[model samples]
Every structure is written in C-alpha cells, then in structure tokens.
Target: MRGWGPRAAGRRRRLRFDGWIAGLGTASGTRLVVGHWPRSPFGPFSDVMAEHPDGQRVLLAPTRETADFIRRTYSFDAVRVVPVAVRHAGRTWTVTAGPLDLRFTTGRRGPLGLLLRAVPGPLASRPLWSALTDRPARLLMPGVRTRGTAGRGRREWYGARDLHPVVGVTATWQGADLGGLAPVSPPVRFGFGSAPRAPSLTRITTTVEVGAGEEDRAG
Candidate 1:
C-alpha cells in the first residue's frame, strides 16, 4: 500500500493523497482500506474506527511510490510468492507481493543493506537517512516537511494467506492451496466472489528449481 502525508502550510497534500487513494481503488476494483493513526492515542480500536467512519478505509500514511517503501523488509514467505521482472518508466524492477504487503527491490543491496531489510518492524526506519537529514528532505516536498524512519525490532510471519494476485504481475498460493482455505476474507466470502465449490488442501510443500537453460525441458 502506498501512503502520502500532510504537506506544508496552505498546500494540498491531503487532497493529492485522496486522489491517489481513489485512483488505486478504481484500479483494484476494491476500496484500499487503510489504517489511520489518530493524533490522540486510541483507547483501543477507536482510532481505526474513527478514521474509517464509513468503513475500514481511510487516508494515506506517508510514502511515495511502491519503490519508496519496498526497498527492504525483504524475504517474505506465504502460501505463494510469484516473482517477475517488470519495466516501467525506462527502469527494470523486481516486484514481490505476499499476504501482508507488496515489496519492491532492485536486489542491489548486499550484507548490511540486506540486514536492514530484515530489520523486523518499524525499527527498520531507525538509522535511515530520511530520519536524520531534514533540510534536504524538505526539498523533495513542495514546502517544509518532516522526514524520518521509526522501527521496532523484527517479527516473524510477514503474513499468511491462501492466494494473492498482483494485477499484471504474478500469482501465488500457500497452505490454502490458493483458495482452498475454509473461509476467505469476510468481504470476499460474503460479499462478491464465490467460494470454491470444493477445496481440498493437503498440507504439503514441493520445491522446484530450474537451471538457466533447463526451464523449458524441466517443465
């Protein structure tokens, strides 16, 4: 999910973010339900509910392109993660989307960079240049802005899901056999799509590796 935060005084950052949300919702054929962080701490889930009074969708957080956030938090495993190389705006990028969130990376980072990607949670933001340099960061915005990364430690299980599709990218499935799970998301099971007539998921994992030139032959 992409995010955009508030901008300088008298700027239309929020409006710009709303436009993005609307566009994404149209493209995805579903509302991009966003988690909202309230200015005041929530007693419980009140923050989320308040932000999404109509439903479970709200304003953007603070991010630019998928590239803005997908650089790290690498190595995710779910039911299935299909990877492919994509070309856009004269650039080649690797896009990977799993159960929790979609990720993008250039695969140029090695040990230290790789370690940062594995930094677990918000803690990944810690030590980031954005969190340090404020003056130069503001130039990226229309006016003054606050920039930084906040991270906790790491956590296991980036996500788990039966099936995931990234529009024009790839498809994947996990323990759910790509939709064999008993119950799908509530909106899906009860709202629009039809459940599988009969889904049988055997808890099994099979790994296949194809060499540089043996892909077709192996298949």
Candidate 2:
C-alpha cells in the first residue's frame, strides 16, 4: 500500500470484502459490473455499477448505508437505493436491481483463471502481493489494476483468486432489451480503474484502507 500522510497512516482501518465480480457489456451500449460480496465488514450485500452509452454512471445499492459507503469509495453520476438481488446456479447468474434485469452465463475458466487458481489464496490476498502484481495486472488486462487510491482518503487493493469468461447474456434496462453480450468496450469510469475488457466473472478479495476519521463514517 502507498503511504499517505503520517497521521493518515498512523490512524487507519482496513476492511475486506470477499466475493464475485461480473463484468459485461450489452449491445445496447450499456456496460454493467455487478459485485456480489458474500463476506464483508457490513455483512453480505451486492451492488451494481452501470455505465450507459451516454457515459452516465449509476450505482444501484441495496440500502442507504451501502449506497453511501459505495459512493464514498467510488464515483457515480447517480445513485439508487433499491432491492438488489443476485441469484446464481452453477455457471448462470440472475440479477435484478431497480431498472435493470440481467442474466449471464459463464463458460470454462481460461488460461488466466487457471494461473490465478494456482496462487494460494492467503498469499495472493496480501497487500504486498497485490502491489507486486499491479503492473502485471495492467499488462494482462488493460484498464485493470491491483491497487489504487479510492475516494475519501482511502486506498484499495483488488486480490483476484479466480476468473471465468462470460459467454452469454440477456439484459434489459427499464423494460427495453439491451441486445446481446459484448466486450466492456469503452471501459467504465467509476474509480481508479475499470473491469477487464474481456467481460468475465472474477472471484476477488477487496481490501480498503481508510483513515480513522473516514472509518467512522464508512461504517
């Protein structure tokens, strides 16, 4: 982790979330990244990061608390606190969040997934390991990063454990069909980095380090 000011480094709290992140783009020019965290400081919850063709970024969270926490950790043009539900069966995932209803299927793990699985989870999730892999992550997946500065004086590390390509998708936004699945074309402008351009599902452990002052509000 990069050092901030002395006071900030001295008084900081680390929070971790372990879960699956699915990124995909629809032919209608809408890109969506769904984070379904089954473990976190605030318990299990899921959030959606969406970017429209017009470049409008929106965050759909399950509650006001989750929405606030996400907004503080990332940038968004609009936010909606709604009932976000995610259900998965085997390789298929179904998601319903406010105006969006999406279903996607994952294929067999690719070469990168195989490589990621070889790394021990404990060693891979370490901040030092994340920093060491940052450059390689960028080279392997353009627009993706392992470590970056988050919002509100916070730094974050993305530790990936597994990955699978998204092979199919059918989605709708506000009842209109979003067309077929496509690559995450223009990359999302939510935080310091975007999801992989190839459209896939990644199992990740996200660690966010926040100063003492921000910690109080983050909770």
Candidate 3:
C-alpha cells in the first residue's frame, strides 16, 4: 500500500497487544517495563518462554495481574483486565474489560528556541528561522530522530513477531520540555489498544459519575 493510508492505518491500530511479557528486558541497569503492545515493528510479544544467559528457558507471568512482584515493582504503569458491571434498571451485568487510565510522566516546558537560547543572543534564532522556512530545516535541528518502519526505527529494539487482534488502542503525546534540546513530545496522543499491564483489579476499575437534576427543554 502506498500514500498516507498505510501510515494512518498503522497509527490507528497502534494499541494491539499480544501479552504483558511483550515488554520484557533490562534497560539502564533497571527493568523498567510496561505491558502495552505498541504498533508492529514494536511488539505483541510472546510470553511463552524467556531465555537466560545460560540458555535456560524460564517461566513468566502469562497475564499482567498475576505477574510476580518483580514485574509489577519495576513497571512504570499498572494495568488490568477482568469483568465490569453496570447498574441502571435494577439489573447488573458483567463483561471482560481492560481499561487503561494512564498519565504519562511529564517534564516542564523549556524555552521556545532552546537551541538558540544557548547561541549567545537571538543570532541562534537564525537556525530556527531557516529550519522553519525550509521544510527540511526541521531535520537539521539537533536531537531530532525519526521512527522507522518494517522492523526498523527505535521501536525495533526487539527483533520482531506476528501481529495480533487488537480490540482498541489510544496514544497520548503531550509536549516535552527540552531546555536547550529539541522537542520530544508533540501536542497530544494516547493509546487504549490493551491495558499496558494487568495488576490488581483496584488499579483498573472504571469510575462512573452521575449528575442529578436535568432541566426540561421547553422550560
């Protein structure tokens, strides 16, 4: 497929996930992990077996909630999937539900021309103006990186795996503060494809608020 369709298609299906173990690995001497499955070229990882340096097959939690403390403690986000019930006509019902009420860890906004801010006066703004005036100028800005496709890019940290049925997903990209660096966060984005991880039922409960007293349209 060519044109903008493919990119838009992938963007919409970005939340499909295979399992919680999809996000397993050690980084920065820390095992900061989450269970959310990003778009393909990223994951939908198989939780079947993990290999040790000695080539030993180890067991891992098949689901998020039942995962041991190690997975939970190091995770940046907690997610869960279970049953949800709603009451309206004196009747209650339940259905499998996975809810992601997520809030990204955010940084404060820095100067607009952060790169120029260090250029010893507004002369630094020259680059900013050039980059803005030319479509390709944005590429010249330091720290600007692009995500790759088809098992490439930063998302390809792990090799690859097959795709899975994704019920839904949401991604939220709030702006980031760079000080004298390039912008990291865009305006906004989010994902709801599947819960990033499953923990206690309490962490994923949906809250419903009811408002009292409605006015008549004729009034």
Which candidate ranks first by TM-score, i.e. highest?
A: 2
The TM-scores, one per candidate, come to 0.18, 0.94, 0.18
Error of 2 at 118 (Å): 0.8
What tens-digit string does per-residue lDDT give for candidate 1 at 33-147?
2121121111111000001112332222223222111112111111121222222232122222232231111223334334434544343222233234335434432222223
- Whole-structure CA lDDT of model 1: 0.20
Tens digits of per-residue lDDT, candidate 3, 1-219, equal: 121011222322121122222212221111111333222122222122222223232323334433332222222133333332211121111111233111222222233324323433223212233234333322443322112121111120111121121122122112321122112122101111111121101001011111122111110
Instruction: Return whichever of 2 and 3 wins on TM-score.
Output: 2
CA RMSD of each candidate after superposition = 21.7, 3.9, 20.3
- The order by descending lDDT is 2, 3, 1
Maximum-lDDT candidate = 2
Give the Å shift of residue 51 in candidate 2.
Answer: 0.3
Alpha carbon lDDT at 35, candidate 1:
22
Model 1 stretches astray by more than 4 angstroms? 1-26, 29-90, 99-132, 142-219
